[model samples]
Target chain A: MSNADHHLVAGAEGHQPSLAHHFSSHRQQYEAGKLGMWLFLLTEVLLFGGLFCAYAVFRANRPEIFIWAHQFLDKQLGALNTAVLITSSFTMALAVRCAQWDQRRLSAFFLTLTLVCACVFLGVKYVEYKHKWEEGLLWVRQFQPAEAAASLDESGTSDQQPRHAGIFFSIYFAMTGLHAVHVLAGMGAIGWVLVRTLRGHFNRQYFGPVDYVGLYWHLVDLIWIYLFPLFYLIH
Target chain B: MKPGPSSGTNLTHHNDQPFHAHVVPVIVLLAVFGALLGLTFLSLAATWIDLGTWNLWLAMGIATVKAALVALYFMHLRYDHSFYALVLAAALLFVLLFVCLTLLDTVEYYPDIHAIS
Candidate 1:
């Protein structure tokens, strides 16, 4: 090679600090970021996996409790939240697409829509949790059912005494509560991306942050897809 | 361990592009949304019918289909590198294993446990 080319490679080494010294190319850095995110997501799956295992074990031990207690959850509200999350996931996918196409305005719009949906989902959850609280259906130790629920037992519908039914609430609170935390975190991440997109930080050449956050948002929707049926559709 | 300095950089027109970064059509995304919402309604409706034990399985089956669609299309796992899909599958496999082993132990000890309770 020429002396000038060699000097170009050797000099100005600190020009782009964003590109780490270890990486040979932009593609490699992007791939490494994606791999790291996926590994983090894998750990997240295992975290929730343990909770799901607990849910299954408890449900197996006391089928009647789930059958009786799940009735307290409003299926319509759960279904509405399910639809809200799924729609938000779609918007998130579109936001990533717009960012890739370098359509900054569209990307910001879609991300805003997704953030709104996350808020709506949480609002519905608050309503559901409030109803449960009023009925005194709480976690194991603090659980105490209202008289209306006790009358169902008197009518021979479900022999599950109020206290015994706490298992379902335990699982419900643990799983959905954890999921709600993720939704809040997702909203924050989406808001961050939305601000950056509006400022034209991402475009066709550099949109990894938007894409990665879209994957995370979709995973949140994936978890809710399973949760709705499990908690609300128990016959 | 590094390659020689004389080695040519493997640059391509697509080098800057992320692997499998397809812009899914807006129609496709909406269609997926509609299908997910439809399935949610189906699961809700299924609860009204007295399917006995089959109810839970049916609901789970529907939910699984919806999850698969979201992962494959919305998350772009279908077009992305297969390694990421493998990672997800591995995580799910371990979850399945955990559930099955717990089920086996619980089923065996259930009666005795019930007697104590």
Candidate 2:
């Protein structure tokens, strides 16, 4: 192809330094990447969707089990984690915005804050999980709610513990365990982008990585939004 | 073409100038953050008053709102191309279909299972 034709093929708009050779322009590259990211996120939604369906099925079959079992979940800690995640999402959004504005330092700062929030979330999760372990509030095969049952009795709300209450813990561990894995993955991603931000790899011309990662992080937060109420706030 | 400076609007018309990245305002982000927190508290407070089955519905409804806010603004779905939104909607629709079908089957066969037990 002629030089002009090549320019047209490459992108009528001049070439961006960061633009991939195959893509025509920065916008095209960004749109393609974003569409791909959204598709990936769709699969994530469906993956979690299956678990949520299981939760519905079990809860519908035995609503009492959920009511009694949810009492074991510490609502205050769940609320605290929710707040922490929401704040992290806020900071992540700010990081994306700052990157879009080419504010490298500010973006890095926000990203650091997001990372810290993720750690806090995991720490709190550790505390909660440790408590569960101590009380043997685990999945069906490993469930040993003896101590938990005693506590419930002490509180004077023990009205014949629901049959197969371990099923609730099974679902809880399955759902939250998957979510915590995602949080760990999200931390790695944020850390990756944070390092890149420090290295000044991103500019307004190509902040797609930061933006996509932000989308993923927000999705992690979004899942928790539903999870928090379903698992901890069930009345 | 050179990427132009952001126009500093909540919803920048990406179609008009595809080169510029949409820079959402800090105020808008702060506002969304506040709304999300407010809804979180609202959902929590909902449990305090017994509304029978409505309590679950209320909590789920509030959580849905919070999820929407995160998806729309934090994830930039509002400022993004409609196709992205459509993709998400389609995924959600399929999820709904899957869950509903499964629940229907389970509920229909529940009596048979109970009889066998």
Candidate 3:
């Protein structure tokens, strides 16, 4: 039923099972798949690149709002999530390596670890979002400055409020929200790979799925690398 | 044109080819991970150094380094076919172009818009 199994059925006939009807060899199929994945990743870059451009525009127009609005974020949590995602990426690479060497057990172990890291990253994101909502820091029109906020003046007045502060939160929510979705998707992909690995579906000759999933996971981590510094550290 | 059973025999040596997927060593992966974490802390430290306008650049610079490490090693781009890397480079170029063009228009109209409002 799985592609791998379909390929296995072909293999039983003394032909390469993983090789598609349109492809002549496993190498050609793998190269085609890799090329397709690269094209998909390029689209992903442009997709997020648009959001990043928006963020840069808003920040350029009102640097002070970014300076003030970002104070509500907890750098420690962001940093922790960064480390979490990076470690997960490492495990993902190791998972691909293990699968390449036909080390099934190690491959499964690393995939499981990557899944755990994704969940932990999402959990931390939830905590951070909950804190933001508690402080009335929603996106756009819903953004409300917390009372007794240090960004306020000595009289605790409203006049000292930064202009267009909500824009910062808007960009923040959009970028990180999309990224969190990717994290969830990455978790699903890794889970699938783990299932396949456990079922003895993947070996050195048929690990394209694992390799592609690992690349996707690394791209997720790569996006967060930029997001962390832009949102949490630049202030 | 449909191929027969013998079609796959030609490309079976994919695993042995140079353009085939690179199986990054465990030790290399760990080293890259360590470097990524180190650069992370270095960027954090840059935030505390009061670089003023330079702070943003420093943070971005360090983040770029970390991103490069992930792409080149962890993502195995360095070992992948050059076409994949070229695709990524082109994507980045478009991103830069999009941002620059948008900013140019924004910068030109900002003063007029600000005065009118």
- Residue-by-residue lDDT tens digits, candidate 1, A1-235: 3455435543533355445677644444555677777877888888999999999998888888887888688888999999999889988988898887788998899999999999999999999999888888899897888674877778877755643778899899999999999999999999998988987776554688898898888888999988998899888
> Highest TM-score: which candidate?
2
The TM-score obtained by model 2 is 0.92
Q: Chain A TM-score of model 1 versus the true structure?
A: 0.88
Candidate 1 CAPRI assessment class: acceptable
Residue by residue across B19-54, what tens digits does model 2's lDDT show?
A: 345767899999999999899888888999999999
Specify the CAPRI tier of model 2: acceptable
Error of 1 at A35 (Å): 1.5
User: Residue A231 lDDT in model 1?
Assistant: 90
lDDT of 2 at B95: 89
> Which of candidates 1 and 3 reaches a greater lDDT?
3
DockQ of candidate 3 is: 0.45
Model 2, range A1-235, lDDT digits (tens) per residue?
Answer: 2355436635644555688887765666777888899999999999999999999999888899999899888888998999999999999999998898788999999999999999999999999999999999999999989988998888898667888999999999999999999999999999999999999998866899999999999999999999999999988
Against the true structure, candidate 1 has what lDDT? 0.81
